[model samples]
Target: MWVTSSTDKVLTPSAIALGNFDGIHRGHQKVLQPILQASAVIGCPASARKVIRDSQCPYATVVTFNPHPQEFFTGQSKQLLTPLPEKVKLLEQLGVEQLVLLPFDRELAALSPQQFVEEILMRQLQATRISVGEDFRFGHKRAGTAEDLRAIAAKFGVEVVITSLQTCQGNESEQPTLRISSSAIRQALAEGDIDRANRMLGRAYTLMGTVVKGQQLGKTIGFPTANLQLPPTKLLPRYGVYCVKVFLEGEGENIITQSSIKGVMNIGCRPTVAGNTPTVEVHLLDWAGNLYGKTLTASLEKFLRPEQKFPSIDALKAQIAFDCDLARKILERST
Candidate 1:
């Protein structure tokens, strides 16, 4: 996607979509369809035909925020569905033509919904049309609902579309009718239900960071690992050993260098090793390469067990070997 800093830089007529778009889940997809369809009608070509017409050459843009506006208002707190970079990558994959990242500070947060619509959406983006979820609200106090948007949109010669909530089958086959939200996904991750979390995220939950040097205890145990210094700000799953897939970031055309690997990861302080700090360490099955200064992206696949200290180093080694074998079997079976 072509990312634009400000609305002023948007050179083409635009059909805009609004959302935090945390995970870009199915619910977000429901809202996105109309905007994409409108774009297509306006000569904003589909996936392959990325060209545009002169008058109807509509630019598709998504307006999102940084520092999550909720951090300031809501009592709830947790990791984001996708960080800014990851979010941008996902939007690009979804065929977004432009991305407008708004800095959510005290000043921006205080804008009344009408002012935001007039200044940012109508004037800045020059939105010929706009789409969003039915429940979506904007402006300082979230006083702007679909009705409010429609009322104002008419005055500015803009068209507004409100998408209905998309429902998916939930427990006991009940229809869970709500948009996938970062808050719900965070709760699932906290509970160690990676599968449910993935359902909401529209993909596996991942942690990406630089591989920093750690105490060489894993090497001594014959199971060297790439230690990731996870950001304190990022959401982390329940601390435990899990089956994971590790890959070197920016290695190739592949989003994940390797589709996945049968591997074991420890997500906690090494209690077995005296005085070790909390860390994320992954040992890729049947692979060995220098990774001290490299960056790695590890996606947790399944939670095997919680972090535990074995009686002896031999016992720990034995457990690790078993874990590797189990992971291998699981991977093969899944494939």
Candidate 2:
């Protein structure tokens, strides 16, 4: 993708879309549609695909951040819906022509709202138009509001589009649709409410990581697991064993296969084994593989059971067997 770190780089004719776009949920999609529409209407240079290029695109480019602004500002780095790489992947899938991943550092944080527009959006991107949420803020101390953005656009000879918020209630009970937020999504996951989280996310929440070598403890007990080394910045669900579907990346292909193996995933420190740190271990049923040192992406489709202490290994094994059967039933019903 066309990832430019320096804003000083000049670009071809382009419209700009701006946001953190954490989950790229339905609300984000709504915001982006009009930006693309305006780009098409402007008759700018032909849309250039940026799969592997540094050249700026002639059409729409989505500007987002790495080490999320919130993370940089408040040190609240946990509970991310999508990390930079995954967010880029999703944006590309959605047909973004170019992507600018600005590193959110102290210097970028100190620019005044007007300077941000003149420098980044106008001079740097030469943005013919800019789109963002109503709550969008910019410049040092977040002094710029949507009105400020509109004023900047008028002065800079650019158009400004402010998107409305998207909200929805669960299961047709429309008293009031819950607010779309990363915090709300995290709350749902923390409470083991995958259904509610999915409603906010518009898809299942996924955790990706490299599979690490473990002590073969699961195999010894007849339940082999793929131990994942989750990134420190990645958000984790509530501590518990869950029912999940595992997917593996294939050679020369971008598709993932859902292993037929039903499994129970534990998301916590191995208290029973006196482990120091938390681990996510999955035991696949009716399947076997040599998965050491491979990257695996696991999706928590549903919450099956809570984490608890078993008196002995034998007892733990029996409970795990039961959990697998229960997980299979839950997944079967879901399909």
Best by TM-score: 2
TM-score list, all predictions: 0.86, 0.87
Error (Å) of candidate 2 at residue 137 is 1.1
Query: What tens digits encode model 2's per-residue C-alpha lDDT throughout 1-335?
Result: 46676666535556688888887877787778766776444434434233222223345678877768877878875567787667777777776667787888998899998888887787778787788888888889888998899888898677788988888677653345777777778888888887788888887787778788887788888888889887776778888888877777654343346554456688988766676788888877666666666667777888877787778898988988888999888878876
How well is each residue in 120-156 modelled by candidate 1, as lDDT tens digits? Answer: 8877777888888888888887878987888888898
lDDT (C-alpha, whole model) for all candidates: 0.76, 0.76
- Mark the regions of model 2 whose C-alpha exceeds 4 Å error after superposition: 8-11, 38-57, 75-79, 171-176, 252-262
TM-score of candidate 2 on Cα atoms, chains taken together: 0.87
Q: To one decimal, what is the Cα RMSD in angstroms of model 2 from the true structure?
A: 3.6
Name the runs in model 1 displaced over 4 angstroms: 46-53, 73-78, 171-179, 251-258, 274-276
